[model samples]
Target: MSPLPEVPAAAGVYPITVRWSDMDAYRHVNNVQYLRLFEEARVYAFKDWFGADRDLIDEGLLVVSQAIDYLVPMEFAYAPARVAIWCSGTGAASFDLGYAVAGPEGDDTVYARGRVTLVAYDLLEQRPRRLGEAEREVLGTVRGEPPALRGDRSAAGSRGHR
Candidate 1:
């Protein structure tokens, strides 16, 4: 397999445990479980980025889209895998989070790369909401380029909207 690209410096590094249940019949981590891993990382990351005092989830941050590229099969292991996450893009009401699932720090084997688009929403109104200035400022601290997944197009030329 090709060597994975270097993770962005601004990314938050989170160690996520790989449960045996995450393995599939093929003896590798199930493709679907990658999403779960990403979710686990996000839980840890958001708390760090936005602070534990804020309840962003309760306030309504919704996942609008997600994409993952599996580069190498990840076998089950006792040690937790490291998931690096960072804000890749921001808009008026939504933001993109890029993820890289790899071996823990000092280990370069990246198993997958993924991105998720999340929109601020109003739970009471049941509609999308614009991101507040504080939210934007928090996201900016971790902003960085998206992961270089295979067949990725340049963001400026191809990415259409939030």
Candidate 2:
């Protein structure tokens, strides 16, 4: 096998003890469950970076899109899986979060990779909102490390703010 890529530092990491219910008839994690795994890690990253700003949810970002790549099938395990996540980039009114779900040991056995694009919104006005200086600064404070996994489809790997 090709040597695995480096484990880039993440903005946040979540330990995922795959639930019994996460498995399908084949005993592998259901494909859809991967989204949840990504969500868990991303949310943790948001909380870690934003802290009090977490309340911005009311008039802040919403997931405009989410996409994932499955590399290896995963099974429920007592040893928690490691879901490493970070803010890969950002735009005028949106930010992209990157994720890697891997075996507890590390990213060498990556099970899946994903990106979630969140668009800022005005909850009261019912429309999109431009990012403020504060918001931009917060996003910049997250992960500055370059993406470790090659993003085969999206530009989250290196298209916007690093």
Candidate 3:
């Protein structure tokens, strides 16, 4: 398969362990497991981006939407998979994060591309909440272009991948 587009310079790269159970009978990582890998990366990224003292999960961030495009099948390996993530878009109450699952930095074999839209929420108030200035500022540091996934009509004039 052709190598995926280069990951943005501002993106955060997190190495995610691929569990043996993550593989399917097809001998490749299951499509659904990609989401888990993304989640693992986010957890590590948030801590580093927002600082360990700040707990965004406890403060409330909810996944409103998610999408992924499988570009190549990946088999389980001893080395952890590298997931590069960045802020793609931002709003008052929500933001979009782009993800690329691939091999180590020098390796260009991207297995998948994905995006997740998350909303700032108030668990105590049981309602969506606006993002704080501090949160927005943090997001700005990691801002980059969205993943050019298949079926993503929002990506320029080019038709999405089949």
Candidate 4:
């Protein structure tokens, strides 16, 4: 199969304040905390797409894969850091997201990169489902580049295989 195209820029950016709870014994942001930050940004961006649906999975979106790259260690700061995320590739049953975390405004340095694949699924049937036209259109607004163009550094040794 051919490779997917990459999104030229982040579709949306979310501000994240570093908290004491996010730091590790090394006095730097914990590795796991990066994933949490990505989730925060992704969830916030998707709220519009999810609409009034309290149960997000009611529409069948489920995270099937994830990858992240840590570029620099970080510490707590008063200013809010920015997490930029965007949709890229879309398939019959899934779509991909790309993300980057940057330092506070002005400084605005990127410190991490991430990607995830979300698949439509049938909870009752316990199986994957295809992306519908409405779902594709909603994702199309921010969709463009695939993360592989940035090196495809997904999470290493994740709990589940892709």
Candidate 5:
């Protein structure tokens, strides 16, 4: 496969306010909570594009893989950050989704970035399955480049596997 393009950040504004609970003893947003922000943006994007009925989660799909790169630690003062998401690599059985977190004003001074690969599954078959027509249609519609993989050059290398 060729190198993936630099996927432009999909503009998504999830009006989230920093809560006390999000802060850790160090007073920065917990590392794990940043993942939640990414999820929230993705869920909203899917619903906004495909409607709530055919929800991705309800389709019995789960995030099979994820990678996050923390750029700047979010403090309590950085409330109401916007989360952006985009897509790339709609492979036969799976696709790569990317995310970016930034403060308001839609800046690209990324506070965090992530990529998640998810595969469609047939519960009865008890294994991963190819992307369905409807699913492919939805994923293919995502335009622009995908966020870059952090750390090692390739996604697999970044995952620390040979």
Candidate 6:
């Protein structure tokens, strides 16, 4: 297996616990539920980086693409996981957000890692738009890190910001 990528200590971390319904029939957390954890993390990151009042949906920004890599299965009642979000990179019309889902354990053992690229879009125009200044400023603060730039860009594309 390829070595897991290194994650920075300063990467924003949002604490989340497994919900009872998150487990599958086999008793392990379902693969799909992990994405929900990442979603919660992203919301927190948006509020922290941007303003809490950021309502991307109303602004017509929504997630268009996402990719996740599952490492090891998590138990139903495992300790709270820390989902970390790092600003991967920014294009003229889009930007990428990388995620590391680490157990309550140390950082090296990320249960999963992934990236989602968001685009700024004008719903009325039905086309991608440039990211706003405020949003860019929030992303700029988390740009200078290894995992952020080191991830895949072929996966990057424009979609809505939310």
Compared with the true structure, all predictions reach lDDT values of 0.87, 0.73, 0.88, 0.72, 0.70, 0.72
- Across 37-109, the per-residue lDDT of candidate 2 in tens digits comes to 8877666666667785565565566898777878889877777788877777888888877777887764468
- Of 3 and 5, the candidate ahead on lDDT is 3
Off by over 4 Å in 3: 1-5, 154-162
Clashing pairs in 1: none
lDDT of 4 by residue, 1-162 (tens): 111122245367778777888889999889888888888877788886656664355556788877777878877788877887788778899888888777777655667878888888888898998877877787888775654423433433444223
TM-score each candidate: 0.90, 0.80, 0.90, 0.79, 0.79, 0.76
- Prediction 5 global C-alpha lDDT: 0.70
Cα TM-score of candidate 2: 0.80
Candidate 3 vs. true structure, TM-score: 0.90
Residue-level lDDT tens digits of model 6 in 1-162: 112247654468777788888988988779899879978887777777777677664566657777777777777545677778878878777887888877664544677877777787889998888887877887888763524322345434544233
Could you give me the TM-score of model 4 versus the true structure?
Answer: 0.79
Error of 1 at 112 (Å): 0.2
Candidate 5 TM-score over all chains jointly: 0.79
Q: Which residue runs does candidate 6 get wrong by more than 4 Å?
A: 1-5, 105-108, 144-162
**Which candidate should be chosen as best, given lDDT against the real structure?**
3
User: In candidate 2, residue 144 scores what lDDT?
Assistant: 49
Residue 127, model 1: lDDT of 94
Ranking of all predicted structures according to lDDT, beginning with the best and ending with the worst:
3, 1, 2, 4, 6, 5
Query: What's every prediction's RMSD, in angstroms?
Result: 3.5, 4.8, 4.2, 6.5, 5.3, 6.1
